[model samples]
Target: MKKPVISGNTISIPSNQEFLADVDLFIEGVLRGYEIDESVIADIAISVSELVNNAICHGNKSEFEQSVKVCLKWINRKVEIYVSDHGNGFKFESIDSPIADENLMKEVGRGLFIVKSLMDSVDFKITPEGTTVVITKAIQ
Candidate 1:
């Protein structure tokens, strides 16, 4: 497995799930440095994990050669995180509702839903280069 590389406020890793813990550690450490509450930190962590998983699985299709990049920024007591993957983007609008009766039993597809619920704002940018999901939460 390729080790995660951290540079400043961003971390990049091969398209694999094993390095998720490393990402979590880096993120939590930064949040702690900002003195964010444990509950808020937990919510941000969960949302980040979901986006990373999506980037690894659906975004990069588990291609070991591809890379996923996570960038975090702090602005006016709010944190914004961007998770990007080197893969063809998907149509965000096409995702089925995870809470729908027909999809409730499925074990997947809840990541975006949960992220949206936990984060103050969530947005997606799909370009020819890749797909980036931006999540923001207020620490104040």
Candidate 2:
């Protein structure tokens, strides 16, 4: 499907794991609009996919009734993404070290870790409403 792009911003369904593709399409389209290089786009897309997957399965608990939301924007040569979910919120520190030698073999607990590595800045805000994780990476 041809992706839509507008002034470096886009939004789409956050319904389920399947929507990860939609997020990728939207992100890549917008990045291309700014003439961003494909390598940098891949890094941002990976970070976004990790966060969106977490929001769908962990945050929204895969509840069909609940949905995650993703918004992308660019400011001052930095790409910013906001991934929010309609489930119980969690603190940033609650996640364990997935790469620890002892935990290295685990199949999970590594999404946020990958995100932190790819983005220039990563932070979260948890409230009764939901959890919003914001990530940014500089575009050069």
Candidate 3:
């Protein structure tokens, strides 16, 4: 079996939210090279931004010394992205329901929901060491 090669398409960004644009640029560049459609690219961009924010705030606890790593992979008509962080992970169940009547207007609790809605699949591997969120989008 040919295992998925883990290329060095990785970026270590500061724990600042401002660097989200850098992440977007890197991701878009790679996807564009793959010849993916613009609408699909935008959806992936939104998902990446959400995950990066989570890594910086919830995963790394917003410590400037801490950094978030976003790893990218392209294989078998699918684009895979992993957003990893240094701090402990959060409970996925605790994320509020964005579409619920009470929480519909809140700015928070929408990222994860948006990610699920946009991507074909979303998975999380979390531990005390850190959290790695794997997101996949179909290119075919």
Candidate 4:
């Protein structure tokens, strides 16, 4: 788990922030291959990076033994990405709104908000094994 591993459209990396750039590069490259607009690629990349960061930091708790997995797919003129981490899941509903007046000045806690704002849809799948975040954005 010292380095990122790539298998087709999926990339798995140890729970470390250093590999965030690697994930971003892989994702942006794939999006570009489909000739997606630059703005759309940036939006998707930002969302993916935010999710991956959460997977490494929050989901995996920065434990090197844990790993983060990201999978990308294109379907129906849309791009869907799934990010998973090996850790107990949390209650998504409990997250306070980032735009709330009390949370507006906080330096953290904005990742999910940003992801949801940029992507067409965001869903969470929680299981005893771990949590997975699925995000989709239309390419057209």
For candidate 3, the per-residue lDDT at 111 reads 92
RMSD of each: 1.3, 3.4, 5.7, 0.8
> Once superposed on the true structure, which residue ranges of model 2 sit more than 4 Å away at CA?
1-8
Candidate 1 lDDT tens digits, 8-110 = 9999999888889999999999889998899999999999999999999999999988899999999998899999997677776799999999999998999
Clash number for every model? 0, 0, 0, 0
Per-residue lDDT, model 4, residue 77, is: 97
Task: Give the backbone clash total of model 2.
Answer: 0
Sorted on TM-score, best first, the list reads 4, 1, 3, 2
Task: Give each model's whole-structure lDDT.
Answer: 0.92, 0.80, 0.86, 0.92
What would the TM-scores of all predictions be? 0.95, 0.89, 0.91, 0.97
lDDT of 1 at 101: 100
After superposing candidate 1 on the true structure, give the runs of residues whose Cα lies further than 4 Å from its correct spot.
none
Which is the better candidate, 1 or 2, if ranked by lDDT? 1
lDDT (10s digit) by residue, model 2, range 56-117: 79888877557667788778998888988876777768788997899999989898899998
Kindly provide the TM-score of model 4 when superposed on the true structure, using C-alpha atoms. 0.97
Positional deviation of residue 138's Cα in model 1 after best superposition, in angstroms: 1.2
Alpha-carbon shift of residue 13 in model 3 (angstroms): 0.6
Q: Which stretches of candidate 3 lie over 4 Å from their true place?
A: 1-7
